[model samples]
Target chain A: MRVRLRRQATLLATVAGLLLAATPVAQAYEPVNIVHTEKVQAGPYPITVGFSTWPLRAIQSLDFTFAPDGGIEGKSGTLTMTPATRSTESRKRPLVRHPRKLEVWGLDIRALEEQGDWTFRFRLDGPEGPGEGALTLTALEPPGPPMALNWSLSTLPLIGLVAFLAIAWRRTRAEVLAG
Target chain B: MDLTAPGAHGVRAAATPRTAARGMPTAMALLAGSVLGLVGLTWDVQWHTDVGPDTFFTLPHLFIYAGSALSGLAALVAVLGATAAARAGRPLDPTVGGASVGVFGRTFTAPVGYLISGVGAAVFLLYGMWDLWWHGVYGFDAVIDSPPHIGLLLSGIVTMVGTIMVFAAAAEHRWGRVGTDVSIALTAANVTITVLGLTDVGGPVDAVHTAMAWLVVILLLTAAGFRPTRGGAVIMAGWLAVIQAVTWWFSPWAAYAYADAVGLPVRDYINGVPVMPALMPMALIAVALLIEPILKAARAHGNRWLPVAAGAVAGALVAALQGIQDSIVYTYPTPGPGTLLPTAVAGALLGALAGHLGWRFGHMLRLVNRTRPEGN
Candidate 1:
């Protein structure tokens, strides 16, 4: 009878262990899935650029991750972006940790203002040496209706307000004159 | 101000006075809300500069929305109270301190000021959906001049104007006039700071900004001069300075503490001084000094162009003041004859128009006291 009881306990333990082992590890944050990646050679240092959203759309927010061949250590970098049209000034800033994905340098929920092929220039300083490279990313037109159409729809409130105010004014005046 | 009376169920009320003092709390609430909104804006600028845009529901945004919500809530309370009071056969104008607007063909009456405030609040809140769509299309804005952002800020200014009207109705009271002065100052600072895109270190746009900003200062000053209170415009200018001083301290501290609390590290690069430490036209006292005497002369002699002259001089000086501020703060090319000449030419036109407009608004405010304008 004792042997049977021991056997039952062992069976329960084995089943629990199997279930625990089969289950995936808990995610500490909302996981950022890198949908597409591009390779750029910054001299001696080979870097990988990952985008959370594939078929990048202009003005659409997406997470970007930049990782070297190995882990990021004893390294710093700056990112400069020139728009596709190149009509505006290029934006330059230091590369910082993605607000959500803290382990690597990234831009979280950033978007390209203009559509077409935008250039991203990266200057990296690392333990191995200094390296620089450029990547041209194609940002398709923004999703949904044209922005002009959206603006036309959005401005309906203003028109409604004007009409309402006019009505309110006239009605109030009529009542006052009657009095 | 017993707003808790189970409403009159939509009865029409008279536009007569009940108790002038009862509306004080509501006026105070309006002022506090507008000021809080300004405070939040200052913090927001710092947040954007110190930290990157991570999400929409950041702390600074909450402050801003909360402040606007407070203003909207106050306006709603006033409108409903007045409506209920009117339905109960109580007079509406005294409660609203102005004329009453008949709602639903006089089913409900709303005060002009409170109603305007309510409309502005509704627009601001509703505009958020449009702004959200804009973000979806445009992503995070690299600059503050996004179309939706401009709309949102403009609506808030409308609310600020409503706040001024709320006080303007009760301007007969000493405290009421003081309230008017403070609200005007806040509105001016808000316009100048938020519209900094209109003015920058250099370019022709600065001229445009200078002209508009000059007109705003002159208009508000001229309007305040018509108030019954002595030194009203000067007091407004002093309040502007006070806002500057407070913002210089509050902005940095709020950003640091909030970022620390949230465990979000700030960016390494930041502006040397508080973002908009004293972006307002600080030479307002000088303008007020000239304006008061000019206003007095106009009243005694009825010289119409005196206002134009006052506005023109104030405008030129305003342009000069801006140039000086730029030279001191930024290494932007000093405004030579090239910049100053065109700016002054544009300033004169806008300034003159503002002066005329300011007179009408001020005189209207004076008449609201139910007394002779000159007597006030």
Candidate 2:
């Protein structure tokens, strides 16, 4: 009888263990973040872009503007942008330029939406390196939407159920004694 | 019949007070829950190839696995502690003999607590689901990202199985208790799934989190030899607070410093990926763990320093972990200003509220007796 009791206890534990061991996914479904920034002390500042998220899909928008250090001479410059997929690293996209100060408020280059080999090259026409490379652009297509699989709210009903059992069990024991 | 046996009546009567003391587990559960809330929020982790061989070998995977393991360890600790403590006091009444049988004709020899564990497992899973939705899926914009996709699936399975166990255990307890092997099997299956489901091997930091969790479990079990009730709860809470606080502070600092050293931006924004808010939750977890033990100990001992000490430990850990974790990331890409601050603030506030509410609700209620008539 003792052995049987021990076995039963073990079974109960096994079940609980299995429940916990199951893979637990997150509730949120936010997009991956991989943008970096640099503040230049001189006139133009340099900015490097980093991308993460396998199976490159698409970028909806890329917008940038110039913020002068001390004086604002209607900051105008000839700029270039290039993109290369992962596969063909050397097949670089040429620098597509705009003559005016602020070109393309929001550029959506849909052509770069191919499968393989992707990288973007940027060069702003200004003084050499230091403060001459200031640029800010928004990369679009932040993942699909946040997922709903949070544990806290999901477990509220369970809390209620546990309470019910505890109460019921306590009562049963009480009755067995009273009887 | 044995109620009249030599010394049997004395033993059975003694069981009454201890049985009454069974009420203490409920309080411990509340305390553990609060601690879970705290650590779950405050712990921070980062994955990188830049660390030294020693750190590279240890920390990362620990944080990832800590969540699932903690729940199971907590339940096991509760069971073993209660059973052993009761045994030390007086021989249990043989009247509650044989395994607790359920309505469905199931039978098991383990103490009634085994059956009660189903309730705890269900609560754990449900909490995971809510967390996934609020923080994991909907809260973050990285659903399509590589690693989170794995997180989504793993957390989902845990939640589903946990729910099933809840109902199954309830049915077992209410009807006829299932054998102990069934419970163990349930746990084994869950662990297997998590192990198999993990896509990333995880990094060094994750390993640290896992080790800490393992240590916490061992400490909890060891504490059973002491006061059982008080010791178990305190150790569990303290362990959780320490682990989470350390993790919270470690990640960003590593990221920030690495960025400065490597000459990369403090923060990085991948094209489709969203910057993560992993740190805020770490702070929250630290605060919650701090409050649980303090409140429980305070209510019991009525000592001022107990609460203060708990708070100080929790706060310091949160700050320390935050510092360690942020140093690397703060300088990497520069957190778009005010990005992580809000999460930390929100997590702290929520942790405090949860701590107070959990204590009140858990301890305030008087156990209701609703036993059915005999031979019904």
Candidate 3:
């Protein structure tokens, strides 16, 4: 009886170990696949750009590449986003039909002035459209502040007065209680 | 005869009976201090930037010149006097006679009142440049609405400062004197400005809106002057409703008129994308009006449902406006998420119901004596 119980326990342990090992492999599997790729070079840096032909049936896969002087020191960038609701039109339309641009906001990049080829390589599981394509865009200097400092400085006195009041109030309150 | 008495300085002279001696001085002092302070603010030849059709210029901008500089000067004087008194060994006689100046200059301090009033007025007036430059109201592209687009970097800073001052005065009750008076004055000014806009005098609506912005400030001051009451709540709600109606109906009319003046046959297109925009402002105003009633009802009745009902009313108003606007705008029944009618209707109904019930069960459950103290 003891030998039979030990054999059953060993079998259970082995099966659990196998399931744990397969978990990552299963999770990594995605429906959207990237096929074509392009690397735009600016000096030493490289920007790898990629896109899918159709809206991904489901985003099943994604990968990124970091080029030297791309301001991102190493291959250490991640992309995460939700897709817009897929309408019937989206299914009927090809990925390249319109400007299917994946707009990324708040990229914490420094030394944008540094000349280097920055490439962003990405993969997506798309609908039955262009499996994948790549495009390159140049980084340009952003525009100026909407209102001039001269315009804003007009309110500085108001700002300063409020600050003064707050400080004075605190001091007076303390003195009044102490006295 | 003794000015040293608690109420002597602030009350009517004994022999004079009707005329208040002390109150008069206090009032005069506040007025004089503010005017003098106004001079002091402009004492320095400061180059005030005005955003115009062209780039930034040192030329006098109406709002910056009038509102910020003048009001800011008044605030400076008031603050200086108050601070000086605070620094002096006089113990800062806040409760002069019968007037109650609460902790940390809560109610009107003579100097503080002047300063805040001036600055508040100035800030309120400065909206002309903002409207012209940001919203592209004068046939400019909508893209100029962006912060970086207009070269007015300090827009955010000025807005933040103004907002803080407005809120601070409201919180500190300095609003009772400076903020309130300024708001009333501004509202009156706005009424005139709107008339000018209606006449199409060929200028930005800054003058009109600058005046209009004072309406909320005045209403708030009036509300604060009175105790919390069903009537006051209703008044607040009514004010909000009026604002909503005006924003919805009048704003559209105004926009259409402007479009017509510019030679665009947009009166019929008013039912288009314009209608959708119209509903947003209306719904916003409706929500503002109903929020207080729901809370008050919830507190008075202890009925958790009162707020819910109020919210439903607000939501219904919003949804109806949105539907009306959408029907005007869209010719085809695009039954999807992006469609204006369905989205606005759903939002209004759900929002009103949820907000009413949520608030009823939440805050605004306390009933204070809702009555206005006759005169300040």
Candidate 4:
């Protein structure tokens, strides 16, 4: 009887696994979705900036693609992202091959941590020599409720916990001590 | 059943170590959650490495939250039971815990360990909120040393400490030995994880931070040896090795599996070993064995400074082993903006303090049941 039940369970699990495996592919992370683009002429090279999410917001994950005219071949590039908000540090990243796209350089599922204007400075070095250009990106407030409000709502449970501990201790301290 | 545990009459019947230790089962259960969370943390690191920055609601996040929830739930159960026991007009046994602090007009009672664990869970929520905000402001930078991450790791350490204290309080019982030893291993894991954020392995400054963590390990292991039931430190060392093996095996494998299952295969699948706490070589195990003769000598000769000496040795050894480990795994040690001398000095100083504290804490745990409250 136990063996029969075990075999049935195994069969059920396999079916479920197979069903999940057959589900439609989630394009959420694999393919880069270019929702917006900006053009920059780095000396003789004309480079295009592709953003997965337009009107970039702080803390929201998005992808970025930098495709130069003709192709990325015979050309190595570098990216330096500097936020207008001086409070945050600047980041220097090399133009690596995009994971999914494979033809261009991109940052996959990366988020801008702060809301403000950001400068994307690119240096493309290839057969045309080293060409440099910069573009300003304005990142507005993130989607959904304000950050403060979200934090306030998230911390309610912590406050409740503190209050409960206080009340429980107050009512019990006198009674337990005298007992 | 433990002899001193509550009789059939209930928790009110006796003021014994068993009654105090009533929460041992809960504490151990909480440990499972912590271990799960540590696993998730390690897996999460590997995920971030092989895969790029992902959404907040990823599989790793789920595992972390679930583990935190399980730990929080277990601690909450212990607290509620203790408070109910106190409110029912039963004075809590001191060995286990009792009404120690009052909040506003209300006073709650429980074992100190459970109380601290509960507080840790609450603090974790606060850190979670901070982490969310930090991500919004800082973006999804992969480095571990964010303010919120540090806070989260500290809260985790506090939670682990609470577990250790509970077992230490119940040191009289057989359960306490296993509990304390296991707790020691987990705590060491937690401490190492926290230190990793502060230190970059093989870097001059980073190496010192790694070496400084030897203080806690020495203290805990030394404390374990202080118990009537000896060899606990060695057992804890074994647990550390197990932590390394389990994490090393699970992190990369799970990262790949989860990423594949979710339809987002890794961008760069080819990688070196995963970087996480407890994934490194078991340096503490060797240190543990090496210090035994020293600890024994201290006891045998009544030499007060020997434990401190052991701490110093462990400290220096930690620095040396960490350097060697990083050299083998990553690149050769770099002087990255600093020299190695400061690290050596800091390790010795921290080790000396840890040695002294370990002896003190070990003694305290040994005598946990004996030092009852004044009225009790």
Q: What TM-score would every model get versus the actual structure?
A: 0.77, 0.31, 0.34, 0.72
Better of 1 and 3 by DockQ: 1
- Ordered from best to worst TM-score, the candidate numbers read 1, 4, 3, 2
lDDT of 3 by residue, B1-376 (tens): 1112122123121212122232223333333333322221121111110100121221122223333443354444544544454444233322111211222433233322333344444544454465454333222212222322212212222322232222223321332233223322222222221222222222322222222222222232233222234443334434444433443443344434433333323211122232212222233344445556555655566564554455555444444444444444555453344443443444445644444433421121111101112222
For residues B1-376, write the lDDT of model 1, one tens digit per residue.
2212224433222223335556776777677778878887888887766665544565666656766877888888888887787777754443244455566665556666676677777888877667777666656553565556666776787777677777777765655677777888888778776556464355643554465556465546445545644566677778888998899899888877766666666664455456665466767777777777876676566566776666766666666667666666655577787777667666666677666656545555543323332224
Question: For model 1, what is the error of residue B237's alpha carbon versus the real structure, in angstroms, after optimal superposition?
Answer: 2.0
Give the whole-model CA lDDT for all candidates, comma-separated. Answer: 0.67, 0.32, 0.32, 0.65
Worst 10 residues of 1 chain B by lDDT: B1-10
Q: In candidate 4, how many Å is residue B167 off?
A: 1.9
Best by DockQ: 4
Instruction: Give candidate 3 regions above 4 Å deviation.
Output: A1-139, A143-179, B1-54, B57-61, B88-144, B148-227, B237-280, B283-293, B301-376
- Which pairs clash (backbone N, Cα, C closer than 3 Å) in model 1? B11-B87
User: Over the true interface residues, superposed, what is the Cα RMSD of model 4?
Assistant: 8.1
The i-RMS of every model, in angstroms, reads 7.7, 14.5, 22.2, 8.1
lDDT of 4 by residue, A4-93 (tens): 557756874695477446544442553577988999888789988898777788767677888999899898877888888675546666
In order, the TM-score of chain B in each prediction is 0.87, 0.30, 0.39, 0.84
DockQ of each: 0.09, 0.06, 0.01, 0.13
Cα distance off (Å), candidate 2, residue A17: 20
Name the regions of candidate 2 deviating beyond 4 angstroms.
A1-127, A130-179, B1-45, B48-237, B241-356, B360-376
Best by lDDT: 1
